[model samples]
Target: MLKMFISGSIANNTIPDEVIKSVDVSMDKNYVILVGDAKGVDKNIQDLLKINNYSNVNIYHIGNKPRNLADKNWKQFKVIIDESNPKLFKDGKFTRSAQMIKDKRMVSEADFGLVIWQDVSTNRFGNVQVSKGSLNNIYNLLKMGKPVGLYFVPKPDEGIIKLTDLTYFENGVISNMVNVKTKQYYYEMKSEYEKVETQKKHDKKSQGEQLKFF
Candidate 1:
């Protein structure tokens, strides 16, 4: 049973239909879904899970007090504050830092990440810019050798996302070409992931040398 961490940007109100179908298929395979109690995407996903009666879903919230508790029955993982860390606690109470700790732990515990993403220079939800944080989690999951099934929805009329999807290691093998639009998982792109990783390492090294020369 694959434990899938399902997360996305709060700025997204229009989630793609195909993405919903993909979640349906994943649930059919009994993949346990771990989601957070956030306002936009997370809340929407939970609404669908309730409508479909997906009982295997688990939720993580900032602290013992969840901002979104749509279901009272589902098990909630309270990522309590690191009391020993003064930065995380103010006046002996949990602070906003607990949210980030919860986010990191979600990625670490998952076997796979089913993420819905859209690229933008700045995505503001109310007043918070969230896309970069989601991007960071995706990269961390890739670095951990976990498969991230990314369902990317480009902004209307936009060409493509700027941040290229980093591919994971795949055994050299060939198969029929499917998923032409490339809206599905990127690893299906004919062994393209490893090549991207190689380029990224080279780029990093180049930057380091340039910095050293300064």
Candidate 2:
């Protein structure tokens, strides 16, 4: 079975309950591992899953500081984690680099990844952009041959781009582009990945059968 990894900025309300529902229906029986920075939409997604009785999902909180953690109103977050047996990597007390290392570890362990992020307009880290780290992580995962599905929510004022107007790529190179809406494009990309994965499994099974005869 394919394992899915979900990543996004919880501080921004980009991840919606609808997105979670869509993923649940699309994934069917696949295991979902959610990795997030412990903030706004991240908590929202978790809460929605709990309300919907999704007991098999695993959530990892990668926040390193109290400020980065979920707020007190969401104290149930811990209870949910405990009940779900989700892994907690609370290195927030450590350095930013440490948190980043944990993030990479989670990404490496996942078969596929979904990233939701918005491009930063200002230089928050001197000359560096805010979402730069996230972008780099996504790029690295693609370079390692992991299928990545990216969902970008354009700024509210910016008109939504049709799926046909967008381009997607792996490892900084354009793999394909579509003129449809974002969600439709996601479905198409996911279907293609599933087809490829199915072929890989078949090939592996064939190899195993050949070895058994030897």
Candidate 3:
């Protein structure tokens, strides 16, 4: 059975109908859904799974127990963190590093990923900023040679649209047409984006040298 890793931004408390429809399609296909236990998209997805009475689901977490599980009967894949890593623990609580460990495991186990993204702000570079965790999940899956389908929630009132559905890209590089192909997994986008950024830096350095010689 195909294993699908699904994650989204914590900022988006509600899942758009379009995204839900896609999940339903996955369910119809009997794909094993792999999800996290956090609130927002994770919890929403879990609730959907429970409503459908779907049992082929695995909840990934970083502790003896998950923070939240919509269906208690669903299997839990506990990610044990090393006690020796100080960064893994903070103030008697598991840190983001610990959560990332769980995320990485999900990326490794799944054949592909689905990300629900909402732009939080725009950076100084005119690039749209989104939840790091969601982006990390996408990047990790892409790096692992697994494609990811991205759905963008432009506004709370407006439902999600496939990233390709948008008229313009968000990041100017990673989210562009060439990097993330239409209706396909994000194949080699990370490496390609990096190459473009590197070239930009090289061009700037060469221009600086030319100015010095003048």
Model 1 lowest lDDT segment of ten: 169-178
TM-scores of the models, in the order given:
0.65, 0.52, 0.71
- Candidate 1 on 1-214: residue-level lDDT in tens? 7788888777677656766877899789988888898877788888888888888888997666677867777778887667788778778666546666787888898987866665332434444233544555676676777767666555323221222234322211001221222223333332465688889999999999999977
Judging by lDDT against the true structure, name the best candidate. Answer: 3
Residue 89 accuracy (lDDT) in model 3: 84
TM-score of 3: 0.71
Write model 3 residue lDDT over 188-207, tens digit each, in one string: 44456579889999999999
The candidate maximizing TM-score is 3
Model 3 collision count? 0
User: Between the candidate structures 1 and 2, which one is better when assessed by TM-score?
Assistant: 1
Candidate 2, residue 193: lDDT? 57
> Cα miss at 122, model 2 (Å)?
5.6
Alpha carbon lDDT of each predicted model = 0.66, 0.51, 0.75
TM-score of 2: 0.52
